[model samples]
Each structure stands twice: as structure tokens, then as C-alpha cells.
Target: MRLMFLGDVVGRSGRQALVTHLPRLIERFRTDFVVVNGENAAGGFGITEEIAEEFLDAGADCITTGNHVWDQREALVFIAREPRMIRPINFPPGTPGAGATMLTARNGARVFVANVMGRVFMDALDDPVRPLEAALDYHRLGSEVDAAIVDVHCEATSEKQIFGHMLDGRVSLVTGTHTHVPTADHRVLPGGTAFITDAGMCGAFDGVIGMDKEEPGRRYIERTPGQRMTPATGAATVCGVAVDTDDRTGLANWIAPIRVGGDLEPAVPTRWETA
Candidate 1:
């Protein structure tokens, strides 16, 4: 099975780039399932029902979010009915929507996807390990699901890497998000899970993260919020990771980064299979 996981989508530039490229990328790569992080899709804050639908329409089978998942008030209501979208699993038990869902891929393979948030440098929530353990126990790969993915939306690279190692040999991929900057490490762990500290944001490369430079630049010096941050309206590079999993073990056999447009050098990985 083949899968694609994209990092945070920041504001308009990210949304546009995703809507435009996702379909083409799916076809070019022959991906079976796609999961996108859309927490920042709405003006670099929360995602809306409309934006979630847009992502679904553009080929994403599931959407994952982080701390900003509820920035939009409407999300609280709409998310109850939208099973394709998932928030951080570590959110208090009563949180409106679930953190994991079983979805059928385009090729008819069952795919299980979960989202986990880190406590380090962020909100303190339930331990991710337990929820992850429970989810995997219920949706055992190779037997119940054809593939599994865990999006570690975290601030610390170590936390993300720790989650990656914990799930190694059990899940198909463990990709990180929250930090807009992409990491250099992209490799299949010794246990066969594909891991990356961050998948990077799909937005302007010329600004602070995805926000315009002026506001953040001033705040860094003045230590005060002078103006609200807005998404940078500039050339954007869509970024993500693609992986091919073993059909029997549901573990990654091949992995590569997918970066396109904007200031970054283009990288569309070679196909996973030569035959």
C-alpha cells in the first residue's frame, strides 16, 4: 500500500497550493491513501468545515489537526459529524470528535489514522502512549487495517522522534507536524516505520513560519503583540512525505520527501517500485 502525509497547511497560500497540487500528486504517485494536517488552513489558525471539505474534495482521505484544532468555533459543532477529520487524541476524553478513525483507501485497503499532541512546550493533555496503545490494539495492522499512520503534532523534535520509535515495527508511518520547518531526517527506522521530525508547512517560505514577517519580527524585539499575525501571501512550497508499506507487515519499505514550488528546491521522490 502507498500513502502520503502532508504537514500543516497555513492560511490561503497553503490551501491553494494543496487544492491545486494534491490531485495531480495522487495520480503521479498512484497513492492509495492521503492524510493532511489542516489545523492552520483557516487564516493560519483553525480549520473550518468548509476548508475540511475542500481538503476532502481535493483527495485527502483523512485530515489531522493539532492545538489549533478548535480555533474556529464552528469546528466544535461540525466536527461531531465529520468523521474524516480528527483532532489530537490526547484531548480530554469528552472532546467533541475522536482522534482516530478507520477509513477505506481508494484501493479498498483499510487505513487507520490517529493524531497525537505533545505536552512539551504545549498544552498538557493525557499521555499519548496509552491512546496510541489502545488504538493500535483495536486496529491491529496487517490483520484489521492494511496500513496505519500516526501524526505527531508536536513542538519538540525529541518528543516526535520518541513517538516514532515507540510505534516502530507496528505502524506504517510516523510523520511529525506543528513545526513549520521540515527536518533533514527522513528514513525508515530499523523496525520499518517511516519517520521524520517534521513534514514542513505548505506556505510561503519568505516569512516567519507561515505568517507575514512584520508582526512576528516586531514581537521578537518588543515582546508585545502589536498586530495580529496574518498568513504570508507569497509563493508557497507544498511539502509532504510518501511511503510504500509492506502488504503483509504493514510496515514501510520505502520512504521519500515530496517538496514542490516556492523557494525550496523541488523534490518529488522517485517511485517506490521499479517493476
Candidate 2:
């Protein structure tokens, strides 16, 4: 199975880029399944129902989220109905929406998608490692499960890396999100799972994450909120990772970083097959 996991979509720029580029991207890569993190899709804070549908219409099979999942109250209502839209599994039980969903690719392969937020340097949520373990065990029990993708939404790189190691080989792919800065560590783990520290943000690269640079700069320099930070209205970049997994074992065969347009250097996935 060939899957693509996009990083956090920041605001209008991110959404616009996805709508503009994702369709072509999916065709170019021949991706079987696409997952995008939409936590920051609504004005750089939370995602809205409209934007979620836009992402799905643009070729995303599933949308994942992080701490910003609750920023939009409407999400609470829509999440219940949209099974492909997932929040952090580590949230308090009964939080809302399904944390993991089984999505079928166009080719009829069952793909298990999970979203988990890290406890370190973030919030007082449940242990991320535990939820990940449980999700893997639950899906691996059935032969119907073909691939598993885990979105480790987090703040600390070290924490994400640690969890990646813990889940190495157990899941098909483990990609990080929230930082909005794509790391250069895309690689197939020794255990065969594809991993990346962070998939980066799908917004302008010339600003503070995805927000306008002026407000954030002012807040940092003056230690006061002079104005509300808004999403930078500029050419945006779609950043993330692409992984190819073996059908029989559900392990990664190759992994590559994905960065298209904007200030960041361009990156494309190569056609490589492992023996």
C-alpha cells in the first residue's frame, strides 16, 4: 500500500494549497490512501466541518488532529458523524468522536488510521504509548487489517522520536505533526516501519509556523499581544511524508519526505522497491 500523511494544515493558505495541489499530487504518486492533519486548518487553531469536507473532496481519505481539535465547537458535532475524522486517542475517554477508524482504499484494502497526542511538553492527556499499543494490538488481531497509520501529534521532537522507536515495525507508518516544520529524518526504520519526526505544516513557510509573522514577532519581542495573529496569506507549501508498505506483512518498504512549493526546498518521492 502507498500512503501519504500530510502535516498540520494551518489556515487558508494551507487549505488552499491542499485543494489546489492534492489532486495532482495523488495522481502523480499514485497514492492509495491519503491522511492529512487538520488541527490548525481553521485560522491556525482548530478545524471546521467545511474545511474537513474540502480536504476529503481533494483526495484525503482521512483527517487527523491534535490539541487544537477542540478549538472549534462545531467539530464536536461533526466529529460524531464523520468516522474518518479522528482526534487524539489519548484524550480522556468519552472525549468525542472516534480516535481510530478503519478506512477502505479505492482498491479495497482496509487501512487502520489512529491519531494520538503526546503527553510530554503538551498536556495532561493519557500516556501516548499506551493508546498506541492498544490500537496496534486491536487491529493486528484481525486479518482484515492490512495497514496501520499513526499520527503522533506532539510538541517535543524527542518525545515523538521515542514513540516512533517504540512502535517501530509494529505499525506501517508513524508520522509526527503539530510543529509545522518538516524534519529531514524520513526513513524506513530497522524494523521496517516508515517514520518521520514531523511532517511539517501545510502553510506559508515565511511566517511564524503558519501565522502572520508580525503579530508573533511583536508578542515575542514586547511580551504583549499587540494584535491577533492571523494566517499569512501567501503561497503555501504542502509538507508531509509518503510511505510504501508491503501488502503481506504490513511493513514499510520505503519512505520519503514530501514538500511542494513555497520557501522550503522541493522534495519528491522516488520509485524504490526493496527486495
Candidate 3:
């Protein structure tokens, strides 16, 4: 099974790039399922119902979020109704949305996607490891589900890597997000799970993590308050990882980082070039 996991979508630029290029990506990669991080899709904050629906319409089977999941306010209610939209699994028990969900791909493959947030350098929540273990325990890859994906929305690379190692061999892929900077560590782990320290943000590369550079630049330099940061309106590069998994074992056989458009050089999995 071929699965694609996109990084956090920043703002208008990220959303536009995703809506415009995702279908083509699915076709070119022969993707059976797609998951995207939409935590920053609503103007560099939380995701809104409309934007979440847009991602779904653009072919994303599931959308995951991090600490910013509630920035939009309306998300608190809409997320409960939308099963495909997931927030951090470590949130308090009564949280509005789910932390994991099962989605059927277009080819009839069942995919279990779980979203977890790292506690280091972020808000204190339930231990992520337990929730992730529970999700994996509930859905046995290669038996109950054709594919299992875990999105570790985190700030620290160490924490993300730890989770990847912890879930290796149990899940098809474990990719990180929230840093807005793609790392070069995309590789299949010893346990067969595809892992990347950070999948990067799907937004303009020229800005400061998808926001306009002026305000952030000034604040850092002057150490003084400035106008609110806004999303960069320039061209964006959709960033993510593409994983090809074994149908029988539900383990990743190939993994590649994808960066398209904008300032970042384009990258596509060569294994799919002939497909």
C-alpha cells in the first residue's frame, strides 16, 4: 500500500498549494491513502471546519493536529462531528475530537491514523507513549488494518525520534510535524517503519515558519512587541513524506521526502517515477 503523509499546512499559501497539487500528487505517486496535518491551516493557528473540509475534498483521508488544534474555536465543536479530523491523542479524556480514527481508502484498504503530541517543550498532556500503544494495540497492522500511521506533532526532534523508535515495526510510518522545517532523515528504520524527524510545514519558505518575516524578525532583533504575525502570501512548497508499504506485512518498503514548488527544490520518490 502506498501512503502519503503531509506536514502541517500553515496558512492561505499552504492551503492553496495543497488544494492545487494534492490530487496530482496522489495520481503521480499511486497513493492509496493520504494523511495531512492541518493544525496550522487556519492562518498559522488552529484549523477551521471549512479548511478541514477543503483538505478532505483535496483527497486527504484524514487530518491531524497538535497543540494549535483549538485555535479556531469552532474546531472544538466541528471536530467532534468529523471523525476524519483528529487532535492529539494525549488530550484530556473529555476533549471534543478523537485522537485516532479508522479510515477506508479509495482502494478499500483500512488505515488507522493516530495523532499524538510530544510533551517536551510543549503543553503538558497525557503521556503520548501510552496512548500510541493503545492505538496500536487496538488495531493490529496487517491483520485488522492494512496500514497504520502515527503523526507525532512535536517541537523537539529528540522526542519525535524516540516515538519513532518506540513504535517501529508496529506501525507502517511515524512522521513528525510542527517544526515547519523538513529534515533530511527520511529513512526506513531497522524495524521497518518509515521515520522522519520533521516533515516540515506546507507553506511559504521565505517566511518565518510560514508567517510574514517582518514582525518575527523585528521582535527577535528588538526584543519588543510588534504587530501580530500573519501568514506569508507568497508561493508555498508542499512538504511531506511518501511511504510504500508491503501489502502482506504492512511494513514500509520504501520511503522518500517530497518537497514541491516555492523556494525548496522539488523532490519526488523515484520508485514511483515508473508507476
Candidate 4:
């Protein structure tokens, strides 16, 4: 099965870009499933119900979130109802939204999508590692589920790398989010797990992690802060990763970065050519 995992979608700019071009990209790639990180979709804060619906309308099978999952007040209620919009698994026990879900692919394949947040430099929460193990156990990898995709919403590259290595050979793909800058290390791990340090943000590439540059630049230069920075209003790109898994073993066959439009370089996964 071919799965596309998009990084966090920022504000209007990110949503607009996805709504405008996602249909074409989906059709062209023949993607079977698509998961988009939407933590910042609601005007640079947490996702709102309308924004989540917008993503679903644009052909996303599931939407994942991160630290900003609860930034918007409305999310507290909307997340309770929407099973597709996932928050980090390691949030306090009473968190509104779920951290994992089993979604059916177009071909009737069961794909488990799990979302977990890292503790390193993040909000204090439950141990991320434990729930991940439980979720994976419940999903029953390769048997009860055909494939699994994990979005490690985190800030530290070292923690993300550790989680990827821990889940290697068990999950089909493990990609990082939160740090909006896309990393260059994209490759299949030794254990066949498709891994990337960070999938980047689906917002303005020119700004600081999708936020307007003016406030951040001023804060850096003047050393005196103003109001909080807002999302950049500009041409945005939908950045993500593409993973193709073997239907039988549920192991990754190929992995590639997908950066469509705006300033970043675009990429598509081709058939793996043996060297």
C-alpha cells in the first residue's frame, strides 16, 4: 500500500495550498492513504473543527496533531467526536482525543495510525514510550493490521531518531513533526522501516516554522518582544513523506520526501532501483 504522511499544516496558507493542489497530487500518485498533521491549522494555533473537516474534504484519510493539539478551545469538544483527528498518545490520561486509530484503506486494508509526542523540550506528559508499546500491541502488527504509520510529534531530533530505531522492523513508517524545518535524512532503516527525522510543515517555508517573520526577527534583533507571532500569509507548500509498503509483509519497500510547491524542492518516490 502506498501511504502519504504530510507534516503539520499551519494556518490559512497551508490549508489553502492543500485544498488547491492535493486532489491533483493524490490522483497523480495513486496514493492509497493519506495522513496530514494539522496541529497548527487554525490560524497558527490548535486545529478547529472546520479546519479538520476541510482536510478530510481534501482527501486526507486521517489527521494527526502535536503539542498545539489543544491550542484552540473548540478542539476539546471536536476531538471527542472525531475519531480520525488524533492527538499525541502520551498526553495525560484524560486527554480528549485519541492517540491512535485503525483506518480502512480504499482496498479494505486495515492501517493503524498512531500519534505520540516526545517529552524532550515538550510539555510534561505521560511517558510516550509506554503507550506506544501498548498501542502497537493492541494493533497486533502484520496480523490484525496490514500496515502502521507513526507520527512522532516532537522537538528533539535525538528522541525522534530513538523512537524510530525502537520501532524499526515493526512499523511500516515513522516520521517526525513539530520542528517545521524538513531534514535531509530520508531513508529506510536497516530493519525496513521508512524513517525521516522531520517531515516539515505544510505552511510558508519563508517564515520561522510557518509563523510570520516580522515578530520573530524583531524579537531576535531588538531583543525586546512584542505580541505573539502569527502565521505567515503567503504562498505555502504542502510538505510530507511518501512510503510504499509491501502488501504481504507490511514492510516498507521505498521511502521519499514529498515537498510540493512553494520554495522547497519537490520529490516523488520512484520504483526502487537496485544498485
Candidate 5:
């Protein structure tokens, strides 16, 4: 099974990049399933139902969110009705959206995708580990599910790493989001899970984490709120990772980082070139 996981999408630029490049990516990578984080798709805040649907239409099988999941007020209601869109698993029990779901890939493989938020230097939420364990218990990779992917959206890299290690052999992939910066540590773990501290944001690289530079710069330098932060409108680079898993074991056999367009150095998995 081949799976691709995209990081947080920031505003219009990110959405445009995704809409424009996703089809080509799916074809080039021979992807069977795709998961994307749409937490910051709405003008650098939370995702709206419309945008979430747009992402799903553009080739994402599932859309996951983080702390900003509720930044847009309408999400509180629409998320409950949209099973493809999920909020953090650690959110309060009565939260509107689901935390995990089982989806069938293009190749008829059953894939389980789960979203969880960390509690380090961020909002205090229920323990993410337990929820993840429960999800894995219900959907065992190679048995009940062909592949399992987990998105650990959080502010700290250490926390994300820990979570990834905890679910090592139990899941197919464990990647992070929310930081909007891609980390270079993309590698298959000892337990066969593909891990990356962050898959990075899909938006302009010229600004501060996909936000327009001016507003964030002023607030940091002047130490006072200047104006509302808006998404940068420049060309964007879609950042993400692709994992190829063993059909029998549902464990990652190959892992590669993907960065295309905009300011970042472009990369596509070498395996795709040969394919």
C-alpha cells in the first residue's frame, strides 16, 4: 500500500497549491491513500466545511486537524456531520468530530487514520497515547486494517517523537503537523513505522509559517498586537511524506519526503521516477 500524508494547509495559497498539484502527485507517486491536515486552511485559522470538502475533492481521502480545529466557529457543527474530517482525538469526550476513522483506499485496502494533539506548551487535553492505543486495538494493522496512519499535531517536536516511538510497530506511519516547518528527519523507524517530526506546511515559504511577514514581524519586534495575521498569497510549496508499506505486514518498506514548488528545494521520491 502506498500512502501520502500532507502537513497543515495555510490559507488560499496552500489550498491553491493543493488543488493544483495533488492530482499530479497522486499519479506520480501511485498513491493508494492520502491524508491531509486542513487545520489552518481558512485564512490561517481553522478549516471550514467548504474548504474541507474542497480538500477531499482534490484527492485527500481524509482531512485531519489540530488545536486550530475550532478556530472557525462553523467547524463545531459541520465537523460532527463530516466523518472524513476529524479533530484531535484528545479533545474532550463530547467534541463534535471524530478522532479516527476507517477508510478504503483506491486499491481496496482498509486504512485507519487518526489525529491527536499533544499537551506540551499547548492546550491541556486528554492523553493522546491512550486514545491512539485504543484506535490501534480496534483496528490492528495487517489484520483488521491494511494500513494505519497517525497524525500527531502539536507544538513540540519532542512530544511528537515520543508519540511516534510509542506507536512504532503498531502503525504504518506517524507524522507531525502544526509547526509549519518541515523537519529533515524522515526515516523508517526500527519498528517499521515511518516517522517525521513535521511534514511542514503547504503555503508560501517567504513568510513566517505561511503568514504574511509584516504583521507577525511587528508583533514580535514591537511586542504589541498590530493587526490580524493573514495568510501569505505568494506561490506555495506542498510539503509532505510518502510511505510504501508491505501488503502482508502493513509496515513501511520505503519512506521519502516530498517538497515541490515555491522557495523550497524540490524533491520527489526517486522510486517514483523509476516507476
Candidate 6:
């Protein structure tokens, strides 16, 4: 299976860029499944039902979210109805949305996708390991599911790496989100899982983590909060990772980072392009 995971979509700029180019990306990569992190799609705060639908229309099979999963007031209602859109799994028992789901991919394969938040410097939640492991046990790849992926929505690189190593042989990919900046280290782990510290954001690279520099900068230097942070309006570089899984084992056979347009360097996943 050819799977792709896009990092967080910051706001209008990110959403527009993704909606505009996602179909082309799906065609160019021959992707079988696509997962997008949309926690920040709504004005750089939270995702809305309309925006989640927009992502599905653009070719994403499932949409994952992070710490800001409930940033928008409407999300609390719509997420309960949308099975394709999921929040962190470790949320208390009654959280509106699910943290994991088994969605059918474009190729008619059962794909297990889980969204989990890291407690390191973030909101406190249930310890992710036990629940995540139990979920994986039930959805065992190569038997019950064709492919598996976990979106480690987190702050520290250490926590992200720990998650990756902890679930190394169980899933096809373990990708990180929330830090916004793209990391250079992307590789297929020894256990055949694809991992990256941060898959980065699908928003503008010019600002601080896809936000306008003015406000974040002011707060740091002035030691006082000013205007609310907003998404940068510049052209966005769609940042993400691409993975090709083995048919039998459902483990990653190849992996690569993708960056296109805006301020960052453009990467075309030439391996697949030329394969």
C-alpha cells in the first residue's frame, strides 16, 4: 500500500494549498491511503466539520488531529458523527471523538489509523502506551488490517521517538506532528516502520510554526501577550511523508519526505516518481 501522512494544516493558507494540490498529489504518487492532521485548520485554532469534509473531498482517507482537537466549539459536536475524523485516543472516556479508527482505503484495504497525544509539556491525558498497544493487538497488521499508522501528536522529539521505537514492528508508520518545523531525519526503521521526528506542517514556512511572526515575536520579547496568533497568509509549502508498505507484512518498504511550494525546498518523492 502506498500511504501518505500530511502534518498539521494551520489555517486558510494551509487548507487552500492542500485542497488545491491534494488531488494532483494523489495522482502523482499513486497513493492508496492518505491521512491529514487537521487540528489547526480553523483559523489556526481547531478544525471544523466543513474543513474536515474539505479534506476528504481532496483525497484524504482519514483526518487526524492533535492537542487543539477541540479548539473550535463546533468540533465538539461534529466529531462524534464523523468517523473519518479522530482526536487523541488518550482523552478521558467521554471525549466526543475517537482516537482510533479502521477506515477503508482507496484501494479497499482496511487501514488502522490512531491519533495519540504526548503528555510531555502538553495537556495531561491517559498514558498512551497501554491503550495504543491494546488497540494494535486487536487490529494486528498483516492479519486483521492491511496497514497501520499512528499520528504521534506531540511537543518533545524525545516522546515522538519513544513512541516510534515502542511501536516499531507493529505499525507501518509512526509520524509526528505539532512542532510544525520539518525534520531532516526520515527513514524506515530497522523493524520496517517508517518514522520521522516531525512530519512538519502544511502551512507557510516563513512564520513561526505557521503562525504570523508579529504576535509570537512580540510575546517573547515584550513578556506580555498581545494580539492572538493567526496563520501566516503567505504561500504554504505542503509538508509531509510518503511510505510504501510491503504487501505481505504491511511494513514500510520505502519512505521519503515531501515538501512543495512556498518558502521551503520542493521534494517530489522522486523514488516513487521514477520507480
Q: Against the true structure, candidate 2 has what lDDT?
A: 0.88
TM-score of each: 0.98, 0.96, 0.98, 0.96, 0.98, 0.98
Over 169-189, each residue of candidate 5 has an lDDT whose tens digit, in order, gives 999999999999999999999
The C-alpha RMSD of each candidate to the native structure, in angstroms, is 1.0, 1.8, 0.9, 2.0, 0.9, 0.8
TM-score (C-alpha) between model 6 and the true structure: 0.98
Model 4 residue 232 CA deviation in Å: 1.3
**Pairs that clash in candidate 5:** none
Q: In angstroms, how far off is 213's CA in candidate 1?
A: 0.6
Which sections of candidate 3 miss by over 4 Å?
Answer: none
Clashing pairs in 3: none
**Residue-wise C-alpha lDDT for candidate 3, range 11-85, written one tens digit per residue:** 999999999999999987778999999999998999989999999999999999999999999999999999999
Task: Flag the better candidate by TM-score, 2 or 3.
Answer: 3
Per-residue alpha-carbon lDDT of model 4 for 1-275, expressed as tens digits?
Answer: 88889888999899999887778778777788899999999988998899899999999999999888889989999999998889999988887889999999877889999999988999888999999899999887689899999999889999999999999999999999999988999899999899999998899888888999889999999999699889998889888888889888788988888888888877766542221
lDDT of each: 0.92, 0.88, 0.93, 0.89, 0.93, 0.92
Question: How would you encode candidate 2's per-residue C-alpha lDDT over 1-275 as one tens digit per residue?
Answer: 88899999999999999899899888887889999999999999899999999999999999999999999999999999999899998887888898898999877899999998887789788877677677777798226588889999888999889878988878889899988899988998899889999999899988999999988998888997577689988999999988888888889988988899878888878673332
Model 5: residues with Cα > 4 Å off, grouped in runs = none
What lDDT does candidate 6 reach at residue 14?
Answer: 97
- Compared to the true structure, candidate 1 yields what TM-score? 0.98
Worst 10-residue stretch by lDDT in candidate 3? Answer: 266-275
